[model samples]
Structures are given as structure tokens and as C-alpha cells.
Target chain A: MSALRIALFLILFSFALANENPDAHVFPRPLVIEYPENIEPRFDDEVRLKCASWRFAGEANNLNPWKTIPEECAGYVKDYMTGKGYESDLLRASEEAGVYAQNVELGGDGKDVWVFDVDETLISNLPYYYEHGFGLEVFDSVEFDKWVEKGVAPAIKSSLKLYQDIKRLGFKAFLLTGRSDRHREVTVENLKNAGFQDWDKLVLRLPEDHVKSATTYKSEKRSQMVEEGFRIVGNSGDQWSDLLGSSMSQRSFKLPNPMYFIP
Target chain B: MSALRIALFLILFSFALANENPDAHVFPRPLVIEYPENIEPRFDDEVRLKCASWRFAGEANNLNPWKTIPEECAGYVKDYMTGKGYESDLLRASEEAGVYAQNVELGGDGKDVWVFDVDETLISNLPYYYEHGFGLEVFDSVEFDKWVEKGVAPAIKSSLKLYQDIKRLGFKAFLLTGRSDRHREVTVENLKNAGFQDWDKLVLRLPEDHVKSATTYKSEKRSQMVEEGFRIVGNSGDQWSDLLGSSMSQRSFKLPNPMYFIP
Candidate 1:
């Protein structure tokens, strides 16, 4: 009994030491809670009003480079990324999309296509945003390009699941992104690494295909898909431009992306 | 010509004074910029992992009272509330609903019904939320009730437009809420004050009708509505419970709400 007790103690002590090991990097530093008294308010009424006005008007007028996402909007963005509300919404949408796909009778002519947007839809740029102050700073294309080249974006779990489920239901998955064709190789590597596999096609913007807006560019590509005898049954994107315009899919699902406005 | 210039200068001086007047409240205090150096890294890899886990598991397992909204989630909520993304989505949905309503041949029997949820859908509690910490603080029913009794919640602009448009299109509007029947009088008064007119019926939960879940209770009421010879053509709410279950309306629109989850 004494020998058994000693062995049990040794096992427990080793487990405790393993948990406390800093080399494992398992334990993160506690979140520092700054009291309201300690910190000045990041947003004022005027800034809040401006943010609201910008949100309402941005749809009609394209956003200019001079405008930056207000610091006050950071809280709203954080809630979408880490809160239950956003997860619940995405789950509901993906589940509905799955059901819609299941109910549709596919002709199985190998021309049934489902379109998906890349950023903030299938994969997240959240890590980059988090490190860079959540759009409080001006958008730098060079910095963003470097981040994309790293090819380390995490998959939006629900979307990735939906992709697989739709594919299993006999729909061809096509990745349609506004990313320039120059980064096609890196984008492909990122998508695959992020658990997206066996996509039918990956469409990106070509240098010669300079268009007025993302809506026109994407709509023309979708029209081309339709002209090729492909029936786009379902399309999912984070932007209105991806879902709107001619040759639209029968059903369009929009995932939330509030970080930036795309025309 | 010298006298005219003097007059112009005086007018410009007066205009500037008017703008600077505190009573006008036109200008707000500037937002204070807190450098990243001031903020300790609140979200590390472990924290990120934990946030992701909580998101996935919280739906099945109710979150603890101690768990506060993470800072990153603020962005998501803000996007839903004050970002162009949400406004654009709602406008698109309202337009689509209008087109659908217009195309359908109504019997002019007044049996066609359009359902709208009271809170977050029709009237917004944004003022109350803004005064508070936007759900960073725990919800206190007493405080919320007092705020509600003030009868000052502004109408959600897009929803108000939709309500008027659908009502003009000959669909009978019904306001359904999870608020108890005891507050019906106050709720009615609040709605009236908020510019909602001529809702055919307002449904609220009765004391005896308390069920295990909000979904079951709301679903049962909807079933009762269907039995009363009303064809629910459109139903809209912020919560999934409002749209789900038996006797669902032909179309359902969801407004964004990231503040709280109603079971």
C-alpha cells in the first residue's frame, strides 16, 4: 500500500510539472482589464455619428482611401469574430444552405456550379487584422500582400464544412476571388492548407480584364460560367458585389464581413 | 465694394461662432488614440484558441455568467449595427420582400399577414446599449425594463420603411414580442411613440404559457395564428426563434443583433 501511494504521488507531480512548463506555451498571460477611469474614451459622439453616416452612405458612394475604419467600430468587429451571435448566424446560414442544396434536384450534367468567395467567407484575415489594430490604421496593400503570401489564413469552419457538404451533394465548388491572378499560386496553396480540397475551379482577376468595379468583373465571370452551360445553383460571398448583378445564382448566401467595404 | 467685403466678413464670423456654440452640440469631443504600447496583448494564441472553442461549444452549453464579451467581438457587433454591410443587407432584403409581395396576387381578404418582432427588429434599443457598455457589462433586467418604460427606443430606419411599405401593399402587420403580457400597454405606447402605426395585433407571452424554451412558446403562438385563417407571407426578427418552428411564414428576414442571445 505504501509503495502504491508513492507511485501515485510521483505520477501526479509529473503531470503538474508538465502543465507548468513554459516551453510548452500552453498558458497565455491573463487579459489586462483597464478600468474606464484609467482610459479615455476611444470614441466621441461625433465620431460615432460619422461612423454611422459612413455606413449608411458607403453603399451608394464607393469608399475612398482617405477614409479609415473608426476606432470605435473595433468593438463591433470583435463581437462578430469572437462572439456567439456571429457564430450562431453563420451556422444558421450554412445549415440553411446545406438544406437548400439537398432539396434541389441536380441534373448531374457536371455543370452544376456553386460559387464561393475567398476572404472572410471561406477563410479569415482575422489574424492579420488582430495584429494590425483591427483596421484602426490605414490599409496598406504591400503589408496585406505579404500576409497573403504567407498562406496561413485559417478556414472559416462553418463555410469549409458547407463546401464539403455541397460537394458531397453533387455540386461543383468554384472559388471566385477578387484577388489578382498574380497571387494565384499562393492563394491555391493557402486554400489547400486551410482544409479546402478538390475544388472544381479557382477564379481570380486577370491583368487584361480591367473592369470598372468588382461587381462588373465578378458578374462577367459568372456570366461566362453560365454561357459554358454551368448552372450556378448556389453562390456565397461576404460582399454584395459577389451576389448581385447578371447571371446570379438561384440562391445566394452572404457571410458577414464588416472590416472593409468593397465596391 | 469695401462695404460689401466688410459685410461678408461679419457674416462668416457669425457663422463660425454659431458652429462653435456649445448649446448647438454639433461638435463632439475628439477620440483619444491609445497606442498599442499602452495595451498589453489581451489576445494570445491560447486566448484565441479558447475564444474559438467557446464559440463552437457555447450553443450546446450555456455560457457562464462570468464570461464577458471579448474585445475582438466588438467589431462584429459594430459592423452589424453601424457598418454599411448590415444596412445594405437589410435594404436588399426589404427590396426583395417588396418585389415578392408585389408579384403575389392578393385576394383582398385581409387574411395575408406580415409578422415583425418588436425589439431590435422594429424598435432599436441602441440608445440604451450605447449608454451602457454595449453588452460588455452583464445584462440587468431591472435596468433594461426601466429603459424600456422610458418609451424612447427609436425605430430601426430600414425596418420602419419596410413596415410602411408592406402595410401600403395590403399585408396586415402583426407585432410579436417575447416581452410579458403585463407590459403590453407600455409596449403599445412605446411603439406608437416610435412611429409604428396600425399594427393589427401585438402578441406577448402570458404567465401561464411559460414553456421550456422560447422557441416552443413562440412556435405555438404562430401555429395558433395560422389556424385563425391568416396566411403569414412575411415574418422578420433578429432571433432565429422568431423564424423557426411550425407554421413559418413564406418568407423570413433577420435583422442583425449581436448584443444578446435569447434562448
Candidate 2:
């Protein structure tokens, strides 16, 4: 191709890309599916700001107990959850956790542990969230549990890498999740299928534990681990509830999750 | 203009905009200045993600105690601090705080107080930061005190409005800051000039507090407030140090301050 023709082609390609994403970044997000006809939501400046604001608040734990993603942010969440921004955010957290883990001088007692929050923190439930409206709809535990029964969630690659890296650094890996005892067998199978293994323990919710909030329950479990001589040196979770409250880790890394708020 | 002419104009305009901002959002950021010579940074996919990830971790309190912004992320931080993204993030937190305040049933005794951190919370030090490479340089107390001595720092408009709204809703605003007592006169002048008034108290560091960490000093002060019959119903600050620890508040709102970390 001539230099002039090549330049023209580049301009045309960029124009099409720009038309699709108003905040068009170098790392493009593939549309999950084309919006049908004029039903395509026009993400003007105001809506983008509003949605971005809500996400920021949620991450910082200022916003809570949202029933669903805001109506205006449905498309924004879709793009974010599927984009390089989300992947890069996850990578950032994982990278930091890796560095922090490497620096911590662990006791040779093998009781020093790292806690990993299962769902979005390890194996993403993106497929399930996609089937639902990318957090546009209210959460349904019964339906979500059924999806869990299928045990097919894929590994979040960066998180998996961090998990392995931290484990190799002489930290006992503990998978502390809110998933109940009933799903323990399937959870284990799914975790193994996702390339997660040698977790020192998979701590799941007992029948008596469901009444407490995620923070309280997780804190109690962590306290129990401490009683058994485990030191939680690093904790990573997508939800603040997973990382907050008493007996928390030495350092807590928060992964990106705009799809839903756990509490 | 004819339809075809208008179309041609838009294509050219968007092409120019796209060239400037890879993530060219509908909410445009005014460029601070043109980069001179070959120093104009090319924010490739990698740099954007790394800087963004660092930001995410910092907000969540997973990353801390860094002396300066990463050299590679200096431009990214500049763009973030001066951009609509930062402003919108502030607006979101302020809006949420307003709603929460309205819903709070205040005790009419004037003892239901809300704590506000001064720098980056009520008044901004953006002018100072802009001059210092947007947190790229190590924080220097002697120089920063010089900036505060001038008492010309601008009000963060959203936070000032939130202060007024919450105060009207019967919450007493207490400005708690890490600044030493020496800066009190100028800080007060700065506050009043910035349109802040009738605050219940302006709490600054004391001689004894000079040795204490921000988290420790603030937590002690908050505990003292509780002992004095004041109920801290809400707290807002730019740093996690201001919010974390005992006797925090009924609710705490975190404003964006990527320009610097206090602790």
C-alpha cells in the first residue's frame, strides 16, 4: 500500500473505533454483542461521569448495598468488566500483592498464610454475570448457587499467577470464601479444574455461619485461624467486606469488581 | 454548512481529538500545556494500565508509603489530577455524603458532629501540587508550609458544598487536619477566604501530636470527641489515615486525592 493510502486507512479505522467508544482507549474492548438498532445506549458525558463515580465510591466503600448497577451504568459496567481497564486493574493489584508477598520474611513454621476470596478474586463468575445483565439485575443466590453447581467458572489468570507466586514464597494459601459447606465438593472440583491446587485449606461457611454478615463471618473465621496459629500475612478480595474487620491480614489487596457489591 | 461539509468537519475534529487523548471521553480534559520537544510521553497500553492499577491499589489502601509517583506514571498522574475524572470522582463521593446526611437522624443537642480533613478534603492544594509535578516530587514539609502560609489554597467546590449541606442537616462540621498548630492562623484565614465558616472547631496538631502518626493523632482526637459527648456521625478525608482506626464515624466518605498520599 502507498504511504498516503495507508494513512487514509488508519484514519477511517480510528474513526469507526472512536464512534463505538466515546472514551476510546488504546486497549479496545470488544463489544459483547452489538446493540440492536437504535436501542444502543448513547453514553454522553454525564452518564459516564455518574457511572464512573458510583464505581469509585463502591471501591472505596462509600457506596454500599446497591441492589443492582445503576440503570445508566449498565452499558458502562459492561464495557469496563470486559475491557483492558478491568484486566489491568486486576493485574495491578496482583502485581502489588506479589511484590509485598516477596518482601515479607515468613516464619518457617508453615503457619503463615495468605487468604484469597474465591468468586471474582480468583475464578471470575463473569459468564454468570453476563447471562444476568452485568450487574443490572438484582442478585439471586439460589440461581447463582445453581450456576456454582455447574462448577465451570474460569480462572482469573493474573490472580491465579499471584496465588501461585505467593504460595511459592512460603506462604500457606487459604481459600476463604462465603460459599457454604454444601458446595464444598463442587467448589474444590471447580478450583482444581481452574488450576488452583495445594491450597492449605479451603474455608467455607458452616451452617451456623450464614446468619452473620460477610465481614463478621470472615473475621470470626480468621480469628479461628489465628487461634490455630495461622498468621494471615496477605489478603486479597474483590469486596471490602472480605478484607475488613478484626483479625485481618498484614496487607490487603482489593481486586476490581464493578459487577456487584457483596455488602 | 451543507450536510456533507458538516460531516467532513466532524471527522476532522474527532481525528484531532483522538490523536490527543487515546481514551478520548466525551468529558474532555483541557491540556495544561503543550509538551516541548521530544519529551511528550507516549502513554502506551502498558503505562496506562500500570499507573491506573497503582491508583486502584492506593485508593484501596493496598499500596502505601511511597515517596513519589513512579517516574513512568508522572504524566498519568498529571492527567488524572487535572482531568474531569478526578472532579467527577469527588462529586460522586460528595453526592453520596449529602444523601446519607439527609437521612441521618441527628440529635438536636449540637453534639452530632461530622469530621472533615482539611487539605485535599475541604481546601485543595492543587496549585501547590501542580507546581511540584503532581506528587512526582518527594513531599517537603518546609516548602509545603510555605504554601499553606500564603493561605490562598482554593476550596474543593464539591466538598465545601457538602460541608454546608450536611451542616444544614444538623451535623456540626469539625475540621480535623494533620497540619501543626503553627499554621492555624493562616489555615483559618485560608478556610474563611475559601468560603468556609461556622465550623464547630478547627483541630490541628499539637506539640505532643508532632510525634504521633496521622492515624494515631486523629484516632486519639476522635476518641476525645466521643468522651466530650460529641457523636461523630460522619467523617471525610482524602487519606486513608484520616478514616482508618478506632472511633471513626457512623459513616466515612473518601474524596479522591491522587495528587498525594498523606501517609
Candidate of highest DockQ = 2
What CAPRI grade goes to candidate 2?
acceptable
TM-score for all models, in order of appearance: 0.46, 0.83
lDDT per residue (tens digit) for residues B10-50 in model 2: 44334323443323432222223233435565587678877
lDDT string for model 1 (B16-54, tens) is 233433234211111121223343444554445444333
TM value for model 2: 0.83
Residues A117-218, candidate 1: write the lDDT tens digits.
999888777667766655667778899998787666666667877999989999999899998899999889778766789999999999966564788888
- Angstrom error of the Cα, residue A125, model 1: value is 1.1
DockQ of each: 0.03, 0.42
Clash pairs (backbone) in predicted model 2: none
Residue-pair clashes per prediction, in order, are 18, 0
Stretches of model 2 off by over 4 angstroms after superposition: A1-42, B1-42
Candidate 2 chain B: 10-residue stretch with minimal lDDT: B25-34
RMSD of each: 17.2, 12.2
